[model samples]
Structures are given as structure tokens and as C-alpha cells.
Target: MLQAREGTCNWKANAASGMAVHDDCKLRFLELKAKRTHRFIVFKIEEKQKQVVVEKVGEPTQNYDDFTASLPVDECRYAVYDFDFVTAENCQKSRIFFIAWSPDTSRVRSKMIYASSKDRFKRELDGIQVELQATDPTEMGLDVIKSRAN
Candidate 1:
């Protein structure tokens, strides 16, 4: 298992719930947010490693549906999406959202881990405009996202 080290402090010791956010997770998010190289990114905690990792990356051309579909039906995940929409004024706008996907059917332990580590992981990815926690698909639907974006 890989351990993240910063100065003399082990990430596991300083991080919330002893879970560390992997460096690649932040790097990938920067690519998506700053460079617009990706539409979204799915992240999962490796139980054995006790670290958050990038599980998948949606291509720039992928739609919101694709981002939603990437999440497992019975698993907990962390994701970031670049949401684009037109405001009531007909002006185009974009928002970067940090989504916490914890479905009802997922294991309780998984949910606990994700819930505990979310803040630590989120802090690594700079410039997230909104945060959404969804227990079902409907909670993160396009309409809901658009409302949040506006």
C-alpha cells in the first residue's frame, strides 16, 4: 500500500478518518478543472490502501449522463463534474461540482469511510464551486444540478 507523506506528517495521521487522498486524484482534478481536459472524474477509496484514488475519467465530449452512469449502483464514490448550462438571461455558465455518491444499497462501512474522508479529499481539489451529496440518482439529476448552478 502506498502512503502519502508531507514533511514529517504522514497523511494518514493528519487526514480525517485516517484516509489519505492520493496525489493523482488532485492532479487529475486539476486537469479537468483548470485545463478542461476531462469532463468528470470518478474516485474510490481503496480499502486496503486507505487512500482515495482516481477510478475513471470522463472525456471532454462526454455528457452529464455519462458522468452519472460511471457511478456504481451499489457503491460509494466521489466525483467532480464540470457542469455547463445557460442561465435565464441566455448567458452560458459553468460550475464545477464535487459530488458524493452514496447509494442506499451500498455497504454501511463504505458509506462511513467516504463520509469521513470527503472533507480531506475535497480540500485537495481547488476551485470546486458546489458540493452535492446524493443518495439516489434523482438527487443529482440535471434539473437539480441546474438549480444548484444557478
Candidate 2:
């Protein structure tokens, strides 16, 4: 439980119809439950160009569709994923917003994923394509962002 000092949880289970309800209050409650997933990146994609400076490490998107961030989540830290030169399945086709995190408790080793789907964003990853890697980023929290110890 991650909760605001003066907050509460309201999980409404959608029964009878086998569905889900995203009430405003319920959404707030979900936010309260958010864990400080370390070092996860969230990119805001724009149309018609390569604005990032990362080495081409994967394929590109087809049917290019640029998207903006609906909201900024504190857990999401943005890092550019430059796929300009990549011969991906959909290069220059679909705009990509990469998000990654460490799905581990110890932080000694972790799994990282870079996906285009918002559902796969660093803040909320459920089912999406991701590239996993091993690294320790426990020290990569807000403090690290604020500190210039490089």
C-alpha cells in the first residue's frame, strides 16, 4: 500500500456482468496503490520525426501514429528510444512510447521492457511486448534523478 497521507482505497469489483468499472474515486485509489517502480521510462511521442538520440537497437513501427501522454505519472521517467534507422516491422509507421521497470524485489537483477502501448508503459505494464534486461536500479529513484553524482 502506497497511500497519500490522507487517502483511502476503494476497489469496486464489477460483479454480475463480469466487467470492470473505472470510477474516478476508484482510479484515485488505484493510484494510491502504486508502488515506486524504479527507473521506469515514459516517452512522449510526436509525429513525423526522430527526436531521440539512442542507438538503433530494434525494429521500427508501421502505420505511424504519434501520441501524447494522457497524464504524467511520477513513476514514469522518460528516456529516448531512437529507432530511426531500424528496419523494424513498422518503421516510421507507428509512433513509439517506451517504458521500462525492474520487476523484482531484491533489485540485484531485474527485467526491463520497452513497449509502445500505454498499457505497457513503465507505470502500468500488464500485457505487451518488452525487451528484458538484467540490472540493479534500486538506486535509480527520485533521489538519483535529483542527485548529480555522475
Candidate 3:
């Protein structure tokens, strides 16, 4: 088994949960233990509106309300899927802040999400919603956010 560097793994459990080799890329999976401590929110680009819509996957709460934001769609190059959390009953308590846009218009991918963190992750979605509003898509790319424990 591979070992996780200290502070790299956020969960209460050990970090280096599993590993896989895909061609030239080596992938490591973070293991978030039980307790329904994290939340899951999803955002997809609205091509027609030239914006992004963010919504919580489950029951709505003060912290998990839906939100919408405008982006520099023409300037955005791509939407990258950095990582995902696989939870039971789909009760995610952490916020995965991965939405980002590249300034290089030539990249032309439209949307991107780059979430970076380890176990016990529990970042709030509402907070991210606010951040997205202030973010200038053209100037910021590759922002690493986290999923937090409830």
C-alpha cells in the first residue's frame, strides 16, 4: 500500500486508501470513512445562458442552497474533473469546489472542476458559491477546494 504524506490526508482515517496505474498516469484514491460527514454539490455549464448553475445533490439546507453565476464562457477553455467522492445513499456532507475556467480562450473546454483534498473532507458549498461569484474566470485557474466532514 502507498503511504499518504502527512497533512495531505484530511480524514480521520489513514490517507493512502488505494492506488491505480492508468497508462502513464498514477492515480490515488482517498478513502472517506462512514459518518455522513461530507456534502456533495454539482455544477454544470449552461451553454445557452453563458453561465454555470450550482445545486446541491440532496436535501436543501441553509448551507446547501442552489445558486447561479455568470462566467467568461467565451474565455473559458475547459471543465476539468479533478476528483469525486463515492458515498453511500449519496449523502455527501462536504463541498467539492472544483469549478474553474482558463483564461486561454483557445483551450475551449468550456468548464472545469479541480477538487484537491483527502479523507474526512467537509468543505461547505454555500461558501464556494460566494467565492465563485467573486472569481474572475479569466484570471483564475486550477483552484483547489475541499470537501468537509459534517
Best by lDDT: 1
Per-residue lDDT tens digits of candidate 1, residues 1-150? 234345336655554558878899989998988899999999999999999999999999999999998999999999999998988899998899999999999999999889888987888899999999999999999999989998
Q: Candidate 3 — what's its lDDT? A: 0.29
- Candidate 3 lDDT over residue span 72-121, tens digit each: 34443122122233456785444334344434442333323211111111
Rank candidates by TM-score, best first: 1, 3, 2
Error of 2 at 53 (Å): 20
Greater-lDDT candidate between 1 and 3? 1
On TM-score, the leading prediction is 1
Stretch of 10 with least lDDT, candidate 1: 1-10
For residues 1-150, write the lDDT of model 2, one tens digit per residue: 466422432221111122222232223222323431111223332213312112112222321112112212222223322212223354442112233433344223111111222232233322222232212344333233223211
Return the TM-score for candidate 3, rounded to 2 decimals: 0.22
Q: lDDT of candidate 2 vs native?
A: 0.26
Q: What's the TM-score of every candidate structure?
A: 0.88, 0.19, 0.22
